[model samples]
Target chain A: MSEKIKFTIDGKECYAEPGQTILEAALDNGVYIPSLCYLKDVIPAGSCRICNVKVAGRFMTACTTPVAMGMEVENDIPELNELRVSIIEMLFVSGNHFCPACEKSGNCELQALAYKYTMMVPRYPYLFPEKKPDSGNKKLFIDRNRCILCKRCIRAVKDEQGRSLFAFKNRGNELAISLDHELAENISDELAEEAMEICPVGSILKKEKGFQQPIGHRKFDKQAIGSDIKSVIK
Target chain B: MSKPVVATTSLAGCFGCHMSLLDIDERILDLIELVEFNKSPIDDIKVFTKQCDIGLIEGGCCNSENVEVLRAFRKQCKILVSLGECAIMGGLPALRNGIPIKECIDEAYLNGPTVSENTEKILPNDDELPMLLDKVYPCHEVVKIDYYLPGCPPRADLIWNALIALVTGDEMELPYEVVKFD
Candidate 1:
């Protein structure tokens, strides 16, 4: 058995196994930390800084930072939430996220986060950067306009041989997620569904399936994102 | 005291947001009693005859005419509200933002697959036509926007609640179900 470390998040005592990161420990203990990129059981890329929390008066990403014994972590606070909201807004203005026309609108995590943060309007000017949709793959399509560069699909969507189906195509400013067309052709339906689920936004979508669930019945429609964890913590 | 005058307009939009306003249904009777319409399509008022307490703008500015109308609203109304995705973030109209204006005009008039009839390849150059902007701009970017209701067409209850809150000076209820971005 691994040694358990006790920590305090916003003054509430919590415990986690030795190898667990702060985010893993927090979620396990029913603490909901707003995150866009970090996914459970996957390697934390720390790309999206939405989960940045103050650890011992220093800001750090909870997903990449491991919990230490008696560590004082600030999870929920106005200062941190304000910063997170700004990050969400920055993601919004930088991309051409037309939520209304998107297939994954109701279930999108980025949109859910915007709702959670009450993002009435982004403070920054909309970049409206030109991007194109790639329908090259038989199973799914990639809408680059809606991608937040979270890298979730790239890190999590892999084949039996442990090969990533998605990858980064270009460098900074022009950086975009690209799919391996050869691998994509043979992707199983299950893996195709997994890719869609793994994507935080509507960027990756199964070709034929769209708006499957009716409005008001979709995920995040009735309940706000992280409500389950919030309930557990409460 | 007089009823709070309200004005509304649709600039570079599909008018879906106005349809959502009508989605308020029976409560619109209540709304009619609570507030008076001035320069809104609902009243078929062509121009602003009096100052309005609230102005609900339904789209972004895509042309010179839209800018003029938006500025007129700003001058006549005390509080301005961006009523949907378009007004808040340039919505679908803003999709042309990434593409160069010249290329867009060419695609629409000269080189597109469906433009076979335009053998003359003449772009609309009428003096009466409003000149298109280089890019679609969110209403807030052009003029000061007081509040934003973000939806393709904001939910009817959301619109009703916002109008009520504004008129009665009551706190607006932002329930999770009503605050969707889509």
Candidate 2:
């Protein structure tokens, strides 16, 4: 293997291979860099700013920034953590995230991050924007109200011709993922499930699959997000 | 000294929050020893007999009556807390927030799938009826909320911990397991 690029994050020594991003290296070193919109082996969207880390007085998305030799990065710090918490809070208020009625409540990564940060209430006012759900597709249901526009579905769920199933429909505040019905209608059940799983929020879901996992048994029910990376946190 | 008085109300909620408060289980007796219930459904008191130290409100303001009641609570209680999801952010009732009031009323009283009995197609214009607001409002939007405990029906342990901390003036212990929004 190529000589691992040695670096330090928050004073702790970390190593990275040539092309691995800061987030990948951090995770390999058992350092959890909390992020949304980052799926392993997929092209980085860096749409969600939760994974932003400070390096040399510059804040950049950790998922996109490649690790360098002797790089000093700040992943978890009071100022950065507070900023991260604020981003999470903005995501909560900007969208109509009514967790109680959601199918992906406990399993949701967004909700789990909020839990990790202990957001008692959003700092901003609730917008309560009306975004109706599209249940037109046979296997999938896209609830626009919950979509943070992370582009995970757009980047990951694709047809054999390399056509994306989901695409951005509008601009500015009206921006949303538009699922191509023609492509989506013929989606396999496995792909439908994959589409739902890739979405960080409850925006994309498989139809006819109601809350099958009872409370306390769902994915994030017991463990906080990123807990599996570093069991004993600093 | 007399026990710290606690008052509670359910505005636009399903009373599940109240049930969760009771879900404190045998600790209800312990809670009673720490504080006295006043102007609450648990005691069947319709009106506030006196001033209260803390007022736990479980739901958002959905109507004129809710606003008036919330204002009254603000006047009578020293500390007002938004107890659950509905109170904090309008919850399920607020789903109608995006739609027009006319459409909602028409759908409810006239055009709904279950609507049947109104042969005269009359809408209720009773003077005693509480007027519906344009949209369901979080409690803080109407009046100040000193504290917020967010959950569907906030976990029983969360309610318990918050109550004890409030009554004792100790720091509230917010464990990861209890502070869930689900």
Residues B3-61, model 1: lDDT tens digits:
99999999999999999999999999999999999999998999999999999999999
Model 2: DockQ vs. true structure = 0.83
Clashes of each: 0, 0
lDDT of 1 by residue, A56-169 (tens): 789999999999998999989999999999999999999999998889988999999999987888999988888988999889999999999999998999999999999998
Per-candidate RMSD vs. true structure? 1.5, 1.5
lDDT of 2: 0.92
What would the DockQ be for model 1?
Answer: 0.82
lDDT per prediction? 0.93, 0.92
Q: Residues B21-108, candidate 2, lDDT per residue (tens digit)?
A: 9999999989989999999999999999999999999999999999999999999999999999999999999989889999999998
